[model samples]
Target: MTTTCLVVMGVSGSGKSTVARELADRLGWQMAEADEFHPEANIAKMRAGTPLTDDDREPWLRKLRDWITEHDEHGEDTVVACSALKRRYRDLLRESTARVRFVHLSGTGQVIGDRLAERSDHFMPPGLLGSQFDALEPLADDEDGTAVDVSGTPEQITDTALRALGLQEDAR
Candidate 1:
């Protein structure tokens, strides 16, 4: 059987972690946060209020792709929270994967900026929200995913994503 993986993606502060965690828990799937895969240098760069270039992101994306490969080889369903803001990035993730899908957590800059401002512990400063929005590319028609508006609670958003992805809720 092919392992199925879902990348819960969006710009910073779009509730990617919250929704991804909830969805993963509800589905009984392993959850991975993209930030955890970043090298210290990348974290430091973001902490310095500089947006990461594609060159900077290549290694990080490769690490994520490796995670997908690992889980697929083990036949485990996994959900990952990542800021896959570009089509090429998503394409890179999909390459040679078993069954990968994306769920885009999308919302307006104002909403995401407000959330970022309210966060005190994250490395991504609210000042960088604009760059994230500027670089965001909506999921293309050929992409195997759907975009969910983050106007609702995390649980609600997770439920919507589950329905959209045709995943069944955990019975327990």
Candidate 2:
């Protein structure tokens, strides 16, 4: 079956966007960075080192849900980079479609924090990485997705994800 949605998920600095962008390019899929969906208030809160509450994330999650449906119905494969820090947040995406697959980009706090430190332009502060981990629920092996370590280069991580998702040769 054609995979319609891919959630390149993880906490801050997990390289979700880097991997997801590469996967989407290979699959000819549209890419949506869930960060782009966050309202200014949420961004501001994170910038201030304040963790967001569930209510703060609801609108962002809903936007992702809508995008999943919008892209899937149009036969447009889409990859979304989202922290999806909790199971319930992922469930929101699941509500949109059964074809939604998740790719968990994972790394240790030090690794991710280091990566986030060198990153620029993003509103999510490195300070939020700890809080992100506090909210994460790693996917199980039986789950409908892949989990890849972000310790390698973006190419390596993306390759692992694509291969696991059976889109390895879609790079053509």
Check candidate 2 and list the clashing pairs.
none
* Residue-by-residue lDDT tens digits, candidate 1, 116-171: 88999899999999999899999999999999999999988988888888785551
TM-score of each: 0.96, 0.94
Could you say which candidate leads in TM-score? 1
lDDT of predicted model 1: 0.90
* Predicted candidate 2 versus true structure: per-residue lDDT over 46-161, tens digit per residue: 88889999999999999889988877777788889998878888888888853888999888998989888998988888888887898899986666798898889998998888
Q: State candidate 2's TM-score.
A: 0.94
Model 1 misplaced regions, further than 4 Å: 169-172
RMSD of 1: 1.1
